[model samples]
Target: MTIQAAFTLIINTLGPLQGNREAANIAHIVIEHITGMGRMDRVIYKDKLLSPAQEEQLQQALNALLKHEPVQYVTGKAWFYGLEFTVNRNVLIPRPETEELVEWIVKDTHTPVKILDIGTGSGAIPIALKKDLPAATVWSVDVSAGALEVASQNATQLNLNVHFEQIDILDTTATHSLPLFDIIVSNPPYICESEQKDMEEQVIAYEPRIALFVPDNDALLFYRQIGLLAKEKLVPGGLLYFEINEAFGKEVVALLEKQGFKNVILKQDLYTKDRMVRGEN
Candidate 1:
């Protein structure tokens, strides 16, 4: 089938499930991924026929998408902070708000400094930070061995030296061996179990649940642990950053303050939702 024909089929088939705008966006992403042709190139080859192999690949991807699998996982790649990284069901897909948090750290950082990232899913946080701030020594830790594997592969592919370790941050004793850091950053699992219903079906069905949720009654679990640990791991004047749930921005800020963090700031993302927070040790 011609590229144009296949593209329309994808849009029409998915339009009923996903909204028209989102279906079209997914169509564009899948088309580019399969054909390796950017927007202008795809337009130039609109009438180009997809080879048999390409057709089969398209069908497989469509089936997965019909099941609400994320397009990034479907393509095995996701872009963050201008770099493409491998992704799978083992890790959560990177999002734009996290990029803003990274930018916040990079803006405050200069010279060689020790940095640690908690919950290193896809290693996107540390990898992007390392790419931008080459002088910083970055280390990342996650509880899931599968997640660490994916993060390590990304760091290697990006040709960035980031130390990856397996540690459950929830276990305070497991972090004792970690060295002190000038900056500690985390985009921990802040969504309450009750909030899962509000999230997209693709996210709930295909994304790693361990990386996305916390018990509803203990929604601040990661933030509180990471904050307390940051107090121990961060050098004096070191900064701790988090991407928080909008519903509990004030609560997170209060939690950091209670942890003895000074100059705590609760910042909002582009959408003006309270999404990012930072505190000084």
Candidate 2:
């Protein structure tokens, strides 16, 4: 069958499980990944049929989507801050809220600064920051080696210089002697365990659990620990930025304040819900 024909058929088949738009998007993603034939190419070659191997690969991709897998995980790539990064089950897919966090960091800095991104995942935050600042030293950390490998591959592919380490933030003593940074940022897992039921199936089911949930009661666990680390690691007057749960913005501000961070400010997302906090240590 022709590429357009396959797209329509696959969308129709998967539309019932998810929404029509999501199904159609998945179809297009599968087509592009399987055949390396983008939307424009398919439009230009509307009369052409998929080769037999291409047809089989597209079918497999559709099957994976039908199982409720995320398109990013299925294709092993996601776009963040206008750049493409490799993604998989090993890490959380970068979110729009985190983009705002990066923006805040970029805007707050005055000169060449050293930046440390905790729980870097696909290295989206550091990579975007480096791409924007060009002169800053960007360092990133993640506990999962699998996630770090994907992040390293993305850095190489994007031709951006980023220093990545597989060190757990909770194990900060192992990483002593690192240079004091000018800015410290994180979009660490802030989702309380109780909030899992409300998340979309594609996220809860397909994204890495290690990168999503905190304890049920101590939702501020990462913020608190990172705040302490920031106290020890950040130079006086250095900035610390976080992408927080809208539900816990006030709580995060309080945590930072308790840790002696000053000028704590909470900023709302595009939806006007409290989504980010920045303070100085």
Candidate 1 off by > 4 Å: none
Write model 2 residue lDDT over 14-85, tens digit each, in one string: 989877897888788887887688899988986689899988877778778778888888888888999999
> What's the distance in Å from true for residue 238, model 1?
0.5
Backbone clashes in model 1: 0
Write one digit per residue (lDDT tens) for candidate 1, span 222-281. 998999899999999999999999999999999999989999999999999999999999
The C-alpha lDDT values of all candidates are 0.94, 0.88
Query: Model 1 Cα RMSD, Å?
Result: 1.0
Model 2, 48: alpha-carbon shift in Å?
Answer: 1.0
Q: Highest lDDT: give the candidate number.
A: 1
